[model samples]
Structures are given as C-alpha cells and as structure tokens.
Target: MLAPSPLGRVLLHLSNLLVIAFLLLPIAAVTLGALQAEKTLQADTRALLPPEWTLDNFRVILSGGEQRGAIFEQVTYLPDNVKKIRFAFTNSTVIALSVTVLTLAMGALSAWTIARLRYRWTRWLVNASLLARFVPVITLMIPLYVAFRQLGLLNSVVGVIVALTGFLLPYAILILAPYFDQIPKELEDSARIDGCSRFGAFWRVSLPLAAPGLASCGALVFIISWNELLIPLILVNKAEFMTVPVVINSLVGDVHVFFNLMMAICLLALLPSVILVLLLQKFVVAGLQVGGLKG
Candidate 1:
C-alpha cells in the first residue's frame, strides 16, 4: 500500500485529534467541576466554566467532612458515606491488589494447561471459559447474592475479592493462553532436563518468559477490579466494605447531589488505575502484540 498524500495525512491527524478530544472532554469537565464551588456549578449550568474556583471540595472530602472550608461553610450535613472516603480508598486498594494476584496466579496455570496440553477436556475448558464471558454479570447477581448470603460472605472485602476474581478470571485466561502457547517448549524442557520438576520449570522459565503477558493481564485486571461497582455493590452493602466506585455512587442522593465533591473524589479515585496503566503501558503493548501473533 502507498502512503497517504499530504491532505489525507492532515485529515487522518485531525480525526485522531477529534477522538482524543472526545475522550478527554469528560476528564476536563470533571477537573473543572472539582475546582469550583457547588453554588457556581448550579448557578450557571449554561456556562462552560465556573465563575470562581476553590479547593474546598477536595479539602472537605480529604478531611472526611471535618474541614468545610469557605465553600461549604453554610452546609450542615454531609453523607455518612462521604465521610468514610478513607475506608473506601483502603478497601478499593486491597481488593484491586488481591484480585490482580489471584487472577494472575490462577489464570497463568490454567492458561498454560490449555495452551500446552492436547487433551480434549482442556479444549472444552478453554471454550467454556470463553463462553462464561458471554453471560451478563447482572444475570448472575441474584444467584451470587443468595450464595454469598448463605456462606456469610456478604458485606465483606473478602467477598468482593472473590466475586471480582471469578468474574475477571476468564478474561485473564484468554489474554494469557496465547502468550503461553507462543513460548518455546524447549526452554521448559531444558529446565526440566536440568533436574527441575515440571512445575519448577514452569515457575522459573515459562512464567518469567511470559512476564509481558502477565503485566498486561495484571494491569487490566487491576483496573477492572478497581473500577468494578456492580459486583461490590451487590455483594457488600456496608460502608466499611465499599470500594471507591461504590463511594462515588453513594454521592447521588435522592434530594441533593454533591457534584463538586463527587468530581473531586472521582479524580482522586482515578489516579491509581491511571498510574498503573502508564507504568505498564510498554509491557501491555508488547504483550498484546505478541499474544495476537500466530506461532
């Protein structure tokens, strides 16, 4: 294929810019909303920008509703959930990390088996795993809720972790199996010939060789788990067990909505996943490239 001419190239660049702007518009809105007081936000819904800016929203949220600052001086009541932002942050971090580790460990082993083993059952298992992703998670919520209630796992961080791991495990397996298959079997064989056990060879050789795939799958898992709201919302109703997304959801009350405060919290909530993706982007891109290539 020939390269595009100057006008075509300019059009392509313009299209890309348009897409980027579309994506960033929400972030820009959130930042602007977080910078201003609620009165300014409501006063001029028609305006593109707030009349004045303040960090009082951040101050109130970070201070757990203690320091109202000038912005919230007249406001008397804050949601109980809003005051427990620290708990939500802690719960989200712990759950995301836990889900990432569990998904990677289980996914790697299962993916390796599916990739290396020729058994019919392994093929069936892989297909089944893929099919699981087709079922809407919402449909399973009721059954999961009942089961967790019976197991006394509701309203706990452990419950959220387990639910997220199960929901995300199939995607991890699909992402990782191709990478494992692309690995040279000779590497594991060499490790095995050096007196390493089968599992040991995999642990030391194949696993490390698949580092990029792991990083890719892990970053994706962490982000999904961090942003997951439905599973946690259904599984854990208690504020102490609430994740960042759950806390953000709590901001929408029946009578009033704290748009500025919610936006500030949203910005805070977005940092970890954004930083994780940025740090792992190279590995993620490489892994995706390798995973997609045929042997």
Candidate 2:
C-alpha cells in the first residue's frame, strides 16, 4: 500500500479528533449537569461549569430517609407503585439478578445442546429463539400481564423476573451459541470416550472454555433487566416492587421536576452496570467479536 501523504494524515487525525469530541460532548454535559447545584435544570448566563456544586442532591435522592410527600415517602404521583426510590433499587437488583441467573442457566444449556448435539429440532429451536428476539416486547405485554395476574405474579418482583427472562433468554442463547460452537469438539469427545456422559462432558470440558461468553451474556442480561421500564410499569403496581427505571420515570411527572434528584438517581443506577462492565469488559468484547465474526 502507498504511504499516506502529509495532508491525508492531517485529515485523518482531524477526523478522529472530531469523532472523539462528538462522543464525549454529551457525556461531559451530563456529568456537569449532575454536579450542578440547581435543584431543577435551568439555563443561566454562565459558563459550562456550575457556579456551585453540592452533594445535597445525592443525599436526598440516595440514602436520604424519612421525608413525607417525597417519592421516598408513602407516595407521590407516579404511574407505578414505587413509593420509595430505595425500594425500587432493591426491586431492580433482585429482578435483574434473578433474570440473569435463570437466563444464563437456560441459555447456556440450550446453546450447548444446539451447538454440540446438532439435532434437527435443536437447530430449529436455535433459529426460532433468534426469531423470537425480533418480536417486540409490546406485542406480548398484554398476554404476559394477563398470564402473570392469573398466576398471582403481577405487582411482584417474581413477576418482573419472569417477564424479563422470557425476553432476555433469546439474547443469551444467541450470544452464547456462537461461543460454544467455537470450542474444540475433541475436548468433549475425549471426555465422552473416557465414559463421561454427554452432560458430564459438557460440564467438565466445554463449560470452562465458555466462561468468557457466559460472563458477557450475564452482564448484558443484568444491564437489560436493571434498566427495563415498560414491562415493570405494566405488570407491577406495588410500591416495594418498582424498578430503577420506573422510579426515575415517576420523577418526570412532578410539577417541578427535581433535576438534581433525578440526575442523582441516574448516576446511582449507572454504578452497578459500570462496575460490571469495567471488571468483565475484556471477556465481553472478545465474546461479542467472536460471536459476530465466527459461529
């Protein structure tokens, strides 16, 4: 290949700089906004940096306790039953963890079978699972709500977990199957030759190799379930059962939206997923690339 000219190199650097700037601008704005002293978002004839910064917003929104008529109080106007932000966070954590565990278990088993066993029905189910992912959550909301209510799951954390798992299962299967496919068949065959059952072979040989993929899938599902709003809003109506997104959404209806509190809640919500991604990012990136480019 011909070496780039000086002018071409200059343009390339400028283009790269512009792309970085475009991406960082919104993030910078949000970070600054979150740190601002204003209770509500209002524009002042001031520079990008706020004149004052305070942790009071964080205090009220987070661990700040026992204030009447606050969202954390018995109730304020929100479509959901989340009377308190703390309850919502707890509900979100429980549901998200439950969904992640269930999806990982089911998706890993199903994907392993489809990748290794290679039966006609397994192939069909794999393809069908992918197709199921394309179905919009809206289409199934009414049916799900009715079914969960019939089973006494509505307005409960279990209800949210059950609903989220259905949608997230397909994603786990899709991401994991390719990674399973990448594993060396010889490893499984050797274990089988040593008189290990198929399941045993999978448990001992294949499962270890697929850890990166599982971690990635689990992280994705956790984030998705944590941030979900629509299903939780529709299915749940108990104050203690609201999830984080639903709680933040309720803040919007206030006659004067408390931007500081809202932003603080948002910042807190971002922490768990941020920590997860930071810790497992290498595996996540690798799994995604492999799943996309290979099997």
Q: Write the per-residue lDDT of candidate 2 for residues 234-266, one digit (tens) a residue.
A: 898767777888877766766554555567677
Task: Supply the global lDDT for candidate 2.
Answer: 0.76
lDDT of 1 by residue, 84-196 (tens): 98999999999999999999999999999888775898888778877887878799899999999999999989888988899888888888988899899999998889999
- Model 2, runs deviating above 4 Å: 1-3, 39-46, 65-83, 287-295
Which candidate number would show the highest TM-score if scored against the true structure? Answer: 1
What lDDT does each candidate get? 0.86, 0.76
Worst 10 residues of 1 by lDDT: 286-295
TM-score of each: 0.92, 0.86
In candidate 1 the C-alpha lDDT for residue 69 amounts to 97
Kindly state the number of residue pairs that clash in model 1: 0
